[model samples]
Every structure is written in structure tokens, then in C-alpha cells.
Target: MFELTKLVRPNILSLEPYRCARDDFKVGILLDANENTHGPALSELSETEKILELNRYPDPHQHELKQQIINFRNSKPNKYTETNLEIDNLCLGVGSDESIDMLLRCCCTPGKDKLLVCPPTYGMYGICATINDIEIVKVSLTIPNFQIDIDAILQKVTEDSNIKLLYLTSPGNPTGKLINVDSIVELLKQSYSKWNGLIVIDEAYIDFTAPNGSYSQSMSTLVNQYPNLVVLQTLSKSFGLAGIRLGITYSNKKLSKLLNSMKYPYNISSLTSNVALKATAKEGLAMMQNYVDKIVEQRSIVLKKILDLKYVGKNLGGEDANFILVEILDKNGNPSNEIASKLYNTLAVDNSVVVRFRGNELNCTGGLRISIGTEIENKEMLYKFEKVLNELNA
Candidate 1:
């Protein structure tokens, strides 16, 4: 019942993809794709800048970059990472935003199809759906723990065959918690006759999780095994390479091929590919791990220190990601958006420290999503946050 060909848009399936010259050949005269053979137009350039070849078109397929990503992922000794995972299983995009948009366009036809999202998860899932003219179907994550409302999601999908994609974020954006794996597996089983579709798990914050110093929680391990699974990751978060704008998608080769076919011929730029290649290199991977370790340590310290304040209520999230979500308390000791918003503004404008006010999000009343910073940065935030909270409440 859950057929991929049935699931994808008919036009996307029938259409032919544009072929870039670099797709078949990368060397020689390269008199194709209309790329300027002359070196870059800049007069002054760094050694690395010249090597990047800004004058030419980048590899359309990004096979080498994809392979390097696999190498970085396989550094950890997992069965899937060790075997069966290859360049074919991965797809790279400008950012997860582009990947999200591409998936929306290729699978969910405008005005007819629906996309399911778990609330208090990533905002772009809904934003992209709206942009693509796809209906947004939201199912809120369970209260307090922030786990998926599995029974509700199952029923919704079963009743609605039009729902083509279900989006979930582990170590979510505002929620900062890991979704239950068992619950995910149960849905993927597709016991319901009416529905079973591609499940997109956004793991942008994955590298910062499992505070036990492991990335074992990543849903990527299940990608090769499940044809319906799509795991989205990025170098922007833990890798400190946000400027490079590389987002990764791990799925079965068939679906990967479909995505490749539908995407722009030259979606990944040479600048992004080269920088990402370096960031995912052996040395780069080690450096990223070191930074992740530091952030994890700092997250604990910041959470504990903030929780001590009378104006700060419970730490709502699972404490999994590089950030913490805590409720800003009112005079009566309940979550208060008014006070949180005031504090959020005060911190940004006056104190030179900024944290996201997620009070508008579901189940996140008075919530301030604070990213973990360095020792000095954290100290400044703690001091300024306490001052603002006390002033607002008074």
C-alpha cells in the first residue's frame, strides 16, 4: 500500500532532469555549462581562494563531498556506518531549508497534498509547506516530556491518505528533546491501511546530543534499512560551518536519485562543497567533537545556574541539545509570556545578550531558548538574565 511511485508527484516522476557537463566529465577543456574558463574576475585573492575555482561551475553530483560526509559519519563504529552506507544514500543542499523546500515541491502537490508536522518542532517545516501551497497538518508533541503524540499521529495519518510527508525533529528546535525511537518505529510499520509515507527526521542538533559523548541517537542508522525514512542533518550546527550552508539528507538510493533528478542542476556551489569537504575532513571532525564536548559541559552549567533563580521555573526540555528551555516565572510563580518577552527584549537591546523567546510556541509558555555559550559569554548571560528577570517581575 505504501508505494513510493504512488507517493511522488506524477509530473516529477515523468519529467527529465537537466544534465550538467560536470555530471559526466570534470576535466579537460570543459567547454560546456557556459562556465567562464578564465580564472576568477578578482584581482587580489588568497591561495585558498584561487584554488576554489570561483570562475568555474562546481560538481553537479557532489560525489566526492558526499563520500567525505560518509567517511565522517562512519568514524563511529556502527553496522550501517561501517557497511551498506555509500555516497548514493546521501544528498546535499544549500541548507536544510532548501532540502525541506525540495521535498515539499517534489512530493506534495500544491492545493491537494498535506504535510504533517509535530508542533514545537522546527518552524521551517510549516513555513516551507505554506510556501509550496501545501496544507499544514499539525499534531502537538505530548505535554511536559515533549514526545510525539504517537496515537494521535497514527490515527491522523490512517484517516488521511493525502498526507504525504510527516516531519519530526529530534532534539527539537524549541522543545530540545529526543523523540521516542520505539514510537517512530511503530509508525513506520504502517499497520494502518490508509497511510504510511516518508518520515523526515530533522537532526540538525544531533551532533550536540547523547551527552554521554556519543552520536548514537541519530536516526541516520535506520535510513538504509527503511525506504520510507529520510534523515536531515547539517554542518551548520555543531561543525561551526554555518556560513558554508550545507544540509545533508540520508535516505535509500532510489529516493536519493529521485531528489537528485528533481533538484536544480547546480544546487551545491563549489564554495560550499569545498568548505564542507574541509569541515567534514578527519581533522575537522575531531575539532567538531571537541567543540561539542565543550558545549555539552557548558549547557549543564548554564541550566543549573539559571534554575537557581526564583524567577526561573522548570527546565522544560530534555536537556539534550546545545541549548536549554526554561520558563520565565511571574509573581504568582507560573509561566508568564509577558515577563519573558520583556526580559527577551531587555537582554537583546540593553545587555548585548540574545536568547530566543519561544513563548508563542505550543507548550512553551514563558520559554526562553538559551543557546550554550563560552565561559565568559555564559557568565554575561547569566548576570544579565537574572537582572532583567528581577527588574521585570518587580
Candidate 2:
């Protein structure tokens, strides 16, 4: 029911993307972009450093890397379907941040069209909207459980035709909740049909949900079914390649093609693409899942112990991600933001431990978001965190 062409901005649809030098050919003398033919300037380079493609402009389209991404995403198990997501169905960026920025520009007209984001959710969605000069509409997540309020979202979109993008996260940031498949399907049918806007789902922490491999929770599998649905993911969390700065977009050919058109000429560098390729390889995926297993196991131990502590209040959100969002207690065993703030500061400054204090966010009152770390790291964090909380309580 969603019409792709009608939703995109007129300027973006008609704009001719920058033609890069490497688009046509990668070999030969290649003087098109006016590059130095002598190669990299580093005279004394290591064996690994010497082979790095420093002098040459990286592949603008990155055909091999796209294929690798397609293979990796398609591997995530889905009972419904896995459409043949070809090269055109993928777009790579500096990070998911770049994709968010470009999506706002390509779809919404600044100062006119708007986007909707659930609060106590990821901050980047709003930040990107602000940067693009696009207005943002918010509908807070249902409390006691950080799930989307489907009816409210549907009503909001039905009333506002100018809302061009609706951003949601699976295993949501701060909340750490995975949106159910049924909820996504309902919103896609009702909200999308009425407004015909882009629904961007960020699934950065999906790997932790599954035991070791073949995670079936990814919304990427539904991309082919719902043309308007675009899933953004990154190697930063699951693959442990935050340094490579690779973010991926999976959607229908129309939306994916538009992202490719609007992105910078060489948005992904050679080093980034090379490292991402290696990370998404079969062996790399197995290793990533192994680490996921460890993290999940440690999360169980930490959550159980933390909740038993008299100073800790109710466990706030879902356990689908690598972090925990729980409240800090006052003397009467009530959730207290003041205590949470003090606990957050003391752990970082005094104990040499760091955890995010998400007390200000809606429904996250008195909450401290603690990340699941290595066995040794978690042990130390637990010892230091409990010790600090006790001191603050006393």
C-alpha cells in the first residue's frame, strides 16, 4: 500500500549523484580523479602497512563488500521468507549515524516534514532530525515495559501526513527491548498504510538474543515483504569492529538505491571495507556468536546478583541486549534518581568503573544502564558497584 516514489523528496529523486573515479574501473593507470601515481607517502611501511590502499580512492559502490553483507544478513534465520537481497538491496555508510542523516535529508523536507521517535529510546534519531532541520514528533514507550504504543503511533501518523520517517530500535538502546514480530507487522500494516512514511528499524544488538547463531529475530528478513521497512545495523556491537566504522542498510531496491545515491562519493574507506569483509566472513561470525554466548551468560549472573541486593530496585527493561537497566534504591527501597546519579559518578571517578546513568529518560527513573563485560570485568564492576551503592545508601 506504501508508494515509495511519492514519499521521497522531489529534489532527491531528481538529483544526479556525484560520479566517482573508481566507479568505472579499479585497475590501469587511472588518472581520472587526479591521484598521485607514486603510491603512499609513508616511506618505511610495515608489511601490512605497505599493502594498505592508501594512495587509491576506495570503491565507491563496494560490490564485494555488499555481497558479503547480503550473505551475512540473509543467514539470520527467519520463518517467513528471505528474499534474494542482491547488491542493489544494500548500502554501506561510515556508521549507522550517516544512514540516519541521509534518510532524513532524502525523505523529509527541512522545517516542513517530520519524523517520529519513541522516547527513552536512542538519542541519535532526534539528533539526526535536529541536524537535518526536520521536526520530530515523539510518542513515549509504554511504561512498566518499554514496548511501543501501537495505537498511539497509528493515530499520530494517521493525523499527520507530513511525518516522513518513523524511527524505532530493536533491542532498543537504554531500554534493551526487542520489538515483537507481530507488533512490527501491525504497525507496518496500519501506520504505514495511512501515512506511507519510511519505518527505520535499528537492530544493532541482535546477536545477543540468540544462543550461538541463526538469530530469527531480525527484521531484515521482512525488508523484501515490506518495501517501506529499512533495517540499519553495524559491526560496532556484535562484530566488535567499532574502529572500522561500518554501518549497513538493508531494504528494498528503491530505498537502498536512494541511500547509495545521496551518500558521499567515497563514504567507506578501503581499510574500513577490507576489515568489515573479514569480520563478516564465516569464521568471524562464529567467533562473534561465541562471544555473544559468553556475554549472555555473564548477564544472567550479574542480573541475578544485582536484583537480590537490598539497594537495587525493580529491574526496568528487557534482557535482549548486552546491558542491564535497573533502578537504584533509597532508604525506603524506592527508586531514586539522586541516588542513581551519585552511584553512577562514584563508580566512574572513584572505582575506575563506568556505567550509563539513564535516570532522566521517561520510565527510566533512578535507572543505571550497566553493560555486560568480560568475566573479570563484570566481577570487578559488580564488586565495585555494590560497594558504592551500599556506601551511598548508608
Candidate 3:
């Protein structure tokens, strides 16, 4: 057998993970973790709450949640078409965050193996890598467009650099721009030729994208074709179930098995599994789709207003998702963190509106990442932002 420590960092190999008090007691009143002191949301099977059974262990495999997700994707008209995927090919996690950690655990050897990320993106990927003691290699995406610099990524991969995971976000977070599908396909092909690395495509915002298309566009079909490809998604965003904390990963059987083997025995809680299953029900699926439809419609209106703003520079909308990232500038054409801070602090203080300040976060020094809110909320935000701009000028 190979020495696993040689591949990972010495600290991780020697490390002891955080041991919680709840970890020991198999069955007891779970008053420690701060669960909803009341109970889960009311539903049709309200009588079930009367029968409390906290003794039995949760399913180690979480079969019901996986099957429910599989069935919902098949039966519902979500972006992921039924015929293109199956139940055995998927694995469920506490959230895609867990999946990110699992992948690092399964693949990386702390100090020896490293991972890559395109930043001005998700913080979790890098954070997870660091916690696991995996070295981080940064590849910056092109500004304004937030497209992957394919060459820069390729340049970073060398014989000495044993890169294990490459994390990518389409219609990326903070910036909200989707890398073109062709570019993703090209990166995957190159990665395969260079090393046996995994390409993780985060599709958290996929459902909100334009109908029948994604930032990476029907790339799920590629799971069967590419051995190293993985897709991570969460139930939180579009499903209106952020509190539920469930994520799904789609990949080939080999990769799926590797991830499943490395994850915690009872990673998904029994209650969470139940909640996710109910949320994927026919009615729940329909409700999610309806919500997405409204968000998309509102996204367009917000995009137009941002474009019309004099201080905001060349802004683009919906190549796929609901969030819009616009480049903002001053009358002097300089990158203005002042404008972003002013909008965030002023609007939040004056109108109790919370908009994401992405300017310095992603090296996006002059822009704001606006999430698509309800129509009324969107109009109010636009008006507030306009007032801020006028005041700054005055």
C-alpha cells in the first residue's frame, strides 16, 4: 500500500478533527446544536410530528433523498432533463460545501497534492482546501467578462504541480458571469491530457439561467463521457430552501463511489433528508419553477436600470443566470470602491436594503453584484441607487 501522507500535508495526516459533544451520544434530545426549537415547517403529513422517534440511526447512504431527487428531475421540467441522467449516478451531501470538502478528502494528499480555483468566485473552495491542508493554486478569470483564462490555467499546471481538483463556477458568484460552454469543454479536454485531475463545475445558479440552457449548457451529458468531470448543485437558491442545506453531486460511477466512500457515514441528517424529499415533490418542484420564472423576468428589468445609470459602465445580462454583475465607474473613468461602499452602506442604512459589494472581493474593483429580487424590491433598490449616485455627484 502507498503512504497516503506522502501525497497530502503532514498536518492533515496527523490532525484530529473537531469532536463535538453530540458525536458520542447515539440517541438523546438534540438540544445542543441549536435546531429549530419549535419544529420544521408545517406540511400535509402533520400527524407525523406527534410520533417522535429519535432512537434509530439515520440511513448511512441517504437512499430516499437520492431517489427522490432522481424522480423529481425525471418527472419535473427542470433544466436537468430526466432521460439524460439516472439515480445510481448521483450522490447527496449536506450541501455542495460538504461535497467540496469530500472531494478534497478523497483526492488530495495535504502537502503533496494541490487544487486550483478561479477566484472572484466562491470562498468555500479555497477555504476547504486550506482546512484540509491542500495547497491552493490561483488562476484569475478575465475581468469585466469573468471568463476563465484558459491559458493561465494551463500555464499553472506543470509536471511538478500535482493538481488534484480544479473548481469553476459558471455565472460565477459575486461577479455573476458564466464562462462559455466551449471554454469549459476545452479546459476539460486539456486537463485530461495533462493530469488525472477533477474538474468541478458549480451549478448552484443553473436553474435560474435562461430556459433549457445553462452557463455550461447541457454539460451534464458530459459526465458519462468524461471520467474526471463532476457537477455540484444545491437545493438552497432556486428551491427557496436555503435553510434545508442539501447539495447534490453528479459524476461517473467511479468518481461517485470515491466521494461516497470518503463522506461521513450519516452525513445527511434524517430530518434534512425528509425535508429535501418533500421539497422535491411535484408541487414543490412546480413552485420552484414558478419562482425562477418571476426572478428571470425581474432580472431583465434590473439589468436595464443598471445599464441606464450614468456611473455604471458597460453592463451585461443573462447569458444564463438571474444575478447581474455590472462594471461601475466614476465620471473620471477610475475604478471606484467609494461608489460601491457608498451604495452598500447608504442603501443598507437608509432603506434597509442589502446588496452584495463585490468590488474588491474578486479583484472586481469597481462593480456591484446585484441579486434578482422581487419586482417591488428591485424598483425600490434602483431608485435608492440612483439617489446615491446623484448625492455622490452633488
What TM-score goes with each of the models?
Answer: 0.96, 0.97, 0.82
Candidate 2 vs candidate 3, lDDT winner: 2
Candidate 1 has a TM-score of: 0.96
Alpha carbon deviation, residue 101, candidate 1 (Å): 0.8
Ranking by lDDT: 2, 1, 3
Alpha-carbon shift of residue 158 in model 1 (angstroms): 0.9
Clashes of each: 0, 0, 9
lDDT accuracy of residue 277 in candidate 3:
74
lDDT of 1 at 269: 87
On TM-score, the candidate that comes out on top is 2
lDDT value for model 3: 0.72
User: Model 2, range 1-394, lDDT digits (tens) per residue?
Assistant: 4798999999989878898877778787788888887888886767655576578888888899888877876776555565756788788989888888888988999889999998888999888889889998999888877888999998888788988889998888898888776788788877656778888899999877744244578877778888878989899997889888889888898888887889998889988987887877888878987888899999899999999888998889889999989989898888999999999999999989999999999888899999999999999998998889999989
Off-target runs (Cα >4 Å) in candidate 1 are 77-83, 191-194, 211-215
